[model samples]
Target: MAYTLGIDIGTYETKGILVDHAGAVVAQAARGHQMLVPRPGWAEHRPEEDWWGDFVFVCQTLLRESGVDPRAIKAVGCSAIGPCMLPVDVMGAPLMNGVLYGVDGRAEAEVRDLTDRIGEDVLIARCGNALTSQSVGPKILWLKRQRPELYAQTAHVLTSTSFLVQRLTGEVVIDHYTAANFAPLYDVQTQGWVDDLAEDILPLERLPRLMWSNEIAGEITGRAAAATGLAPGTPVTAGTIDAAAEALSVGVDRPGDMMMMYGSTIFIILRAAERVADRRIWYAPWLFEGEHGSMAGLATSGTLTRWFRDQLARDLDPAEAFRQLATEAAASPPGANGLLLLPYFSGERTPLHDVHAKGAFFGLNLTQTRGDMYRALIEGIAYGTRHVMETFADLGQRPARLRAVGGGTNNRLWLQATSDITGIDQEVCDKTTGASYGDAFLAALAIGAVRRADIAAWNPAAETVAATPDPVYEKGYALFRRLYQQTRDIAVELP
Candidate 1:
């Protein structure tokens, strides 16, 4: 029987899956890793250890456990958290740690400088996006200015997925969906790399060759096969960012369909009928040709919960901590007994895009318990998500259907809170294997094994989180927005 293998490199883990032609799972394996924070406002990963190492481990494990013949796997697909920044040497060795996505705000000054030099309006018109922490162009400029010596030796700039695909197939390529984040370097109209917007960022020649997400990039080499226990000369598709793959896994193909990914961060993607060029949100060419995607996200969601467990819930067992915390949070009522939290620990993304915004727990009282604090934390993330939804609404681009995926979906309180706050129902698919599953499907599509519409058959909707309006949530959301506006000046001044 024919099969497809898919793997995804995430912020804290790597997951690989083997699926048969009928969409039945043959084997699955995973490995966990840490996201390095070398300094405040900086996030990074060791490309070799965290990305390629985990990939090799997971791939080997899946093959051994499933006992599937290497040649039976017809195609391979890969994805990763992106648009990360990593410079490699002539031999493709990493020159430095990979700079993560918007969560890393080290290039804020570069973002400001670029915006000022090339007016925001012009950037939006040409690049289809405005300079923000999510844009890789500023981060490239930051590296050029801050580490000129290293920049001189840099041979190529790549994101996480590009690094992985290059390692696997010896092909230096990037998908357009991920390339859109390289604003000023990627012109949306032309759908190609351009250095005219800002020649100072870096030479466009250093960028990867662009391709669509499902196109075949190259075949896995003998060296890559030896390292990962896969067959030599296996085809590998040009993969996309993890979020886009996750959206596809859940059948988010048509315009007005949205995917609310509850992973390390709360990333939202809405397939648009056409380009929605608003500075408040991001726009990118969809995974397929002749399509567009509008996106938004929060700086922290699951990561905030992890921080809380590590710091405050240390008394609980590490494996059971999240479950215990969720139980505690569920006990607290809608408003957390008048407590509120601003989930900006790593600054804010999306509508605000404020790198200096600080996190806070407002309206704390002596009566508040750990349960109340935890509930408020989850609620804060929900409120932030609603803020993004409101921005989409303002643009006349409300999603007709919202599908939720990722690890955080297991947290019932967080899921329900988001629906209640946003007043939007969320559909959860049967197979929540997420991006890796989507990768396998994309691999199948690349080789003409399946059609786009086949996704619904592969993973159909299993449940729905119906929206329930709550007066308390409405009141809390108002305070949440007001609190941010009133304290913005002070938050930016801190440290």
Candidate 2:
């Protein structure tokens, strides 16, 4: 009765699953945590408490609940929100809270500085990405300039998954898919750490060893075994980011097979036939050796809904609030009765990459209700997603099939609105367990229990969200595009 253990630390929750050799989920466990926002445009997580602690709890819970022998668990796979910026000492102890991905805009100044210093063309040619808040290189520079004392004491700069992998196996390694986001620090052509560019920001030695996602990083140490209640010497794979694992979970492996992840933010990954170098979107090496990956993300998606639920629907019970909002939103008509929203609460990513962008509700009137506002908010995010998809189309990289995953996929309004706005059908798998399930499959791959092509058989797509074209959405999407351009100057001036 051999099995694999998979765990993923997401923005607001950590989930773990145990799967038998046949890909049947034996048991699952999850833990919720808070995303600390110290100030505007900054997001951080206490790695020790939120990441490692959750890993330990989930592992022990899964083993206890399933009553599966710890020795039966073969390989372990992990994924997390990334490419986060976390400075750790030589012992891999956290020196500071982990800075989140594109949503954290503290590196705005550093992004501009590096783009000017390194030349956008050179960066794009070498790393296949431009300097933006999402680029970990800029975040590293921001740390050096803003916290020189801490930077001086730093021994390693680790992302969330790398941190967990090291904790599990005492090996500091990162996957190529995740490392590609470390723009200006990672060389796409060379597929390795760029010493010449990274040395200027931080020593190259501080970077983790690079490997493909399926490769075994190291065996779990005795110390980790004791903490996790798993047997010592269990193999752990070089895992990837949550979105990549989520994509894999839904069998997004072939060229033009895309996965749209509706989580804290909306993340899109498309399997490309070849490496793409574009300023509007990022492309990188895929999980396996030969394939290529193209990606884009919105800064805020699910988070906007959370904010509304907390602030506007505070009187309602937390559990009931979302349902109430959804009920009202579903009842509202397509255009939300002339209300429009820009879901730039955490600024914009992907095509715009505008850190100064601000969220707004346009056409709000006395007639508008909470349900109307909520529908408009979801519709705005859908429009933003369509903007990214159009960029892919411009590059001749439109997705042939779209797989939907993550917590937001469970929201009918959001998913249907996205379909309507983008005019692309979305396929949904029977198991929307998200990234942890993908991690389990990756673990199975590392142990030779599953083939690269076995994912479809393991988790087949069973449903689809077909595009429902609406005249209102057609006109609103056009207005959505114009609103951003007309309001850009004003958004930049916001204090």
TM-score of 1: 0.99
RMSD of each: 0.7, 0.9
Error of 1 at 412 (Å): 0.9
As a TM-score, model 2 comes out at 0.99
Which candidate comes out best when scored by lDDT? 1
Worst 10 residues of 2 by lDDT: 194-203
Model 1 lowest lDDT segment of ten: 34-43
lDDT tens readout by residue for model 2, 303-359:
889999989998899988888899999999999999999999988999999999999
